[model samples]
Target: MKFFNEESDFFGLTKLKERFYSSDHDGLSEADREYINRIKGQNPFGIISMFIGGVSFAFGPIYVAFPIITIIFCFLTCGTFDREKEDNPWTFIIGFCLALIGLFMYLRGVVHELIV
Candidate 1:
């Protein structure tokens, strides 16, 4: 069986499913390919963290737990950039920064409330 993980810009769908594809799709056995394809398709937590981290900033004053959740997701993912393969997996970094910012804002608000 042949599998392809070639990067392509197709109908804006690539952006949505970018995590599903990777450079190391070749040379794997049929079972491994199928396993990665159907079961462990992608590390979705990074993308989930990115979205929630972005929203967490707005929710900083209201939902303090959101930033915490986002931070946890970022740490759990193997999000380092694979320079050997030239892959830029940036979702974790972006999510981490956003989550930190959100958390800081939340703490600042609480401190302000206490002071006032």
Candidate 2:
């Protein structure tokens, strides 16, 4: 049976197939597809890591949690940048800077006990 039509419903598979094969597909190379999948796979892990890192940093020792969380955030920001480089680099830079700032503040607080 014909799959392409205005109202032909093959459990939405036809629509999905249409979207998958549309002109948008032309913009995606094999490497891009692989990278997209890799980023997608890493997203959940990164989110969990970020959450855990934040909790540890907020509640645990600054010396231990600050570096660990900073590293996690750095990795997450790198992954995010890789996924959206074509769209904007500023976001990645901002995220990286924030992570660094957080790390620095934590270190300063632990060392000098100065609120400033």
Candidate 3:
């Protein structure tokens, strides 16, 4: 009935002793540990946003709004990350760019039709 096990890495692939008590992990303070645990407990919104953005690319010009919306979601999700010192922001940036490309392609088709 133990809620917090010192022997458990909270289900992370590495053992708790190896992950939290090892030399490489020794630099983590209590606040850092709490922050990591809190982040691990949250839903993965960035991945979900990327997935939705990727799926939106398939519907084409008729559903132009979907990609646009996905781009906004990507930006919003990306903004939550610590961009100055981390590589994770690139993932969201790439997703946002894909969504933007899809949106532009969709608009290009409409513009061509109107011009012709």
What are the models' TM-scores? 0.51, 0.32, 0.50
Q: Please report, in order, the local distance difference test score of every candidate based on alpha carbons.
A: 0.60, 0.45, 0.55
What's the distance in Å from true for residue 9, model 1? 30
Which model, 2 or 3, shows the larger TM-score? 3
lDDT of 1: 0.60
Error of 3 at 101 (Å): 1.4
lDDT, candidate 2, 24-73, per-residue tens: 54678899876764442223323444555554445333555554565554
| Ranking of all predicted structures according to TM-score, beginning with the best and ending with the worst | 1, 3, 2
User: Least lDDT summed over 10 consecutive residues: which range in candidate 1?
Assistant: 1-10
Q: Which is the better candidate, 1 or 2, if ranked by lDDT?
A: 1
Clashes of each: 0, 0, 0
What tens digits encode model 1's per-residue C-alpha lDDT throughout 1-116? 01112222323333544654555767889898776556532245456667887877667556789888877656544332233433345766787888788799887765235333
- Residue pairs with backbone overlap in model 1: none
Better of 1 and 2 by TM-score: 1
